[model samples]
Target chain A: MSILVEISENLQRGKAKVVKELVQQAIDQGIPVEQILNEGLLSGMSIIGEKFKNNEVYVPEVLVAARAMNQGTQLLKPLMAAAGVKAVGKVCIGTVQGDLHDIGKNLVKMMLEGKGLEVVDLGTDVSAETFVNTAIEQNCQIICCSALLTTTMNVMEDVVKKATEAGIRDKVTIMIGGAPVSDDYCKKIGADIYTSDAASAADAAVNVCS
Target chain B: MIWTREQYIAHCNFEFTGREMFCELFGPLLQLEEEWRQQGASEKEIAMTAFDWDYVLKTGLPCRTGAVTGLKPIILEDTPDHTLSIDNMGRKSLLHKKAATIPLPLEYPVKTADDWLKIKHWYTFDESRIDYGAIESRKALRDKGYLTLFSFPGGFDEPRQLLGEEELCIAYYEDPELIQDMLETMADTAIKVMERVCDKVPLDNLCVHEDLAGKSGPLIGPAQVNEFVAPYYKKVWEAAKSFGAKIFSQDSDGNIEPVIDAFYDAGVNLFYPFEPAAGMDMVKTKQKYGKKFCIKGGIDKHVLRKEKEDIRKELEYKICDITKGGGTIFALDHRIPNGVSIENYRYYVNLGREMLGLPPIQGEGWQRMAF
Candidate 1:
């Protein structure tokens, strides 16, 4: 098997040390930095993302695999920057205002990064104005909002309204996901997208950008 | 009409014994107490009794010098905006005062086996913690027609909350022995505490709080629950049963359908706040489980936020069938939210009573969860 395949397998297994070593060996083999990043590290995470969406794996498994991906990505960053390989899309994400829950938002952020999308996470309890402003300022293609409470999920409507008011409504795709958020809610609020879980959210974000 | 003592007791025993409400919604009710009274609602104080766990165990651990099985929460700092405190679960948090929600956890106390061992001594059997005088006073109040319930914050919820969800889940994989040790120790603590209380206190019911589910399903799956949670519950129910405890119920939020059978098997006959939004349907659950399991709180709470037609439709859909099932309690699936206006709540309550064949409460409706 190729060294790239080994790196992907080790990353999936959450073998961080083995991933780092294999990533270095691939670099020694003079493979393109983008190939190692896209085919090796990212491919592993994308497979895990599919597994997660399928319920073949769960939160803990997703979390550890993300950790392995992070470790390998850290090693590749400097080289990838030198090669001038840009991300497929720029996305800004956060939990909506008055909602302090971060688990869902964090998972979505990780999955987006795993899909080779550059993600700017604004963390939890972010206001509608901030979500719109950050997306515009950062030139992000997508803005994702998360909420855990039925009460707080109403804030997503404000996010949609504010994005429209800011005149960036056409430029950015607003994606909302959480326990209370449904496709009907997304349609009701006039947001661009609503995916049930993080993996699907990343995939949809990628599709929106394309 | 004034309710007789037996009628009230039956309400508390067989029907709902109030519900856990959000402080935001509860705050306004306190202001309208007098208005409710003028509307013919009865006000009664229920006496709660329990052996002081700290005084009994006498662990003398950390800041705590007594039998309380929980951590000796210390106020590390306080400010108008936030209060940084180490709570009883041994998790340090900076509580945001304005939001009235829990503070962010800065650190968890028990991460390893040694941490569990350090806390283990706090739950030892302490005879001195048993307050006979206190037990007698509560029993006398019960005799005088006051509702009395022996509530114990159980093992699974507290342990998981204290340990932090991610850390505990990691510990389940990395250190199964450590997780088992903590749970078994906590179970023993609960058994010991209840055993001592039962020896002296005569209570109406044994209520255990375990918020273990979420909107999707049980936070921990059935297999994990069977391994870690079920045994502890079995021990608790068996212990309470031996004490002649008549009613054994548990309060949990979210869709608990996943673990409902496991809970029933472990002797939890009653479950509360069957949150409809979380996919808990009173009629279907009643059908599947039959009359063996008692259910509380299945009314769609969101109806109050909508129009009166919505409220009527939701109640008419859920109430008649659930009430006929014999063990179903007529209450909102969860606490009334702040979105529910006093008028809407009053209407909901009056409608519920009308469906149950009880007289309508006067203007403003009843405040407490009473007959």
Candidate 2:
């Protein structure tokens, strides 16, 4: 198999050791960094994302797979830097203001990063202003906000409003999610996208970026 | 001072006893802590801050109570700032400025087997920690013709929190023998804590808090519950019942309906914070169980963020309709969030009180769950 395909398979199986070894082997073989990344790590993550969305796999599986992918990416980082490979897109993410939950946000961030997006995690309890400012400063294409509580879920609307008020709404796509958020609520709040889970968030972000 | 089940239910004027009523005052988890920290509040202050309590009262719900299960302290060392430092299950580690500072315990008390060993030794059965101040305050309120209840703590998740989820899951699988070893250790530690607390305080009810589910369902299957959790629950339930406690309750989030029979068999008379997300239908569950269980906290947490009318409609549809002939407590399915405005919470609280026939609090609406 091609070195990229080998890495992708290892990642899909959540074989951290194999993923790292294959990534190093790919580097040793002098494959282009972006090609290795896109074909190997990102492709594996894309499959995992779909599996998760389709309920073929669950959170623990996704998390372990992400861990393997991250390990492989760690090995590819310097090579990618040397190749001057830029990220596919820059995305700013956080759990909305007043919410301390991070599992969902972290999952989304990891999946995004696995897909080769530059993820600027604003961390949990992020305010609308903070999201807007960070999106503007980071030149991000997407502002993804998460909330685990019903009360804190409303902050997604405030985030969208603040993004518009800051005149960056037109420049950035706002995606809101969490346990309590729905697509109807997303449209009601004027968000650009609403996904039920992390994989969907990743696919939507990637789709929007492309 | 003597109260029968009917009188107690009448006093609260709600069907369920231990359920929580939530008024969504805010949207999904916002950084209220950072906002508080930026406002120059101490970490203790930030942790103790209430979310939309005023609005919860305004809603006029019959019950108005919140539990403090997530206030445990964690000692973080060598963790970097900005990057999230979590324990194995991805729960955020507490950041304390000083080691000497005794912050409120927010998370689970146990972390590792070694940590559990250390805590087991250092764990004291201090009856004084039972928050008699709050109990006394409630007692006073009750004396003055207002109904009140105290929160219960410790359950299956408590041990899991101490042992970590991976270790516990593994213990259940590869090291079945170790499950007993760990459960014995946890049971002893918990028994001591319960004995200590019950000695000093007149507990309204003893609650066991265990979050045994994910979005899909319970983490452990039913057979595992029978093997690992049920025996320990029986022990704890018997201990609590022996101590003159009237209600022995278990608090678990998600659709715990699958194991409801096990819970009842284990002597848990009440279940709190019945998550609607997990498809816990009180009407159906009560019908199936047939007074074998007391239901609490079945209202969906999501409804709190809807408009006042929607909130009312759901209250009538989900809560009132289902709980009509059952032993039910009116409460939010989970914690009140900051996204719920003060006004909306009050409206819900008021509605809860009116429905349950509880006396009106001056500022709040109606009352209160999770594991």
C-alpha RMSD over true interface residues, each candidate: 3.1, 7.4
Quickly count the clashes in candidate 2.
89
Model 2 residue runs over 4 Å out of place are: A1-15, A22-61, A81-86, A149-155, A179-184, B1-120, B124-184, B192-206, B211-248, B252-269, B275-293, B300-312, B319-323, B334-371
Give me the displacement of residue B115 in model 2, in angstroms: 5.1
lDDT per residue as tens, model 2, A4-25: 8888887877778889999888
TM-score for each of the candidates: 0.77, 0.62
Q: Per-residue lDDT of B180-296 in model 2, one digit per residue for the tens?
A: 655665556556655654454434455566777644345455566777778877776667666555666677776566667766787777787777765676767766766666776
Q: DockQ of all candidates, in order?
A: 0.29, 0.08
Docking class of 2: incorrect
User: What value does the interface RMSD of model 2 take?
Assistant: 7.4
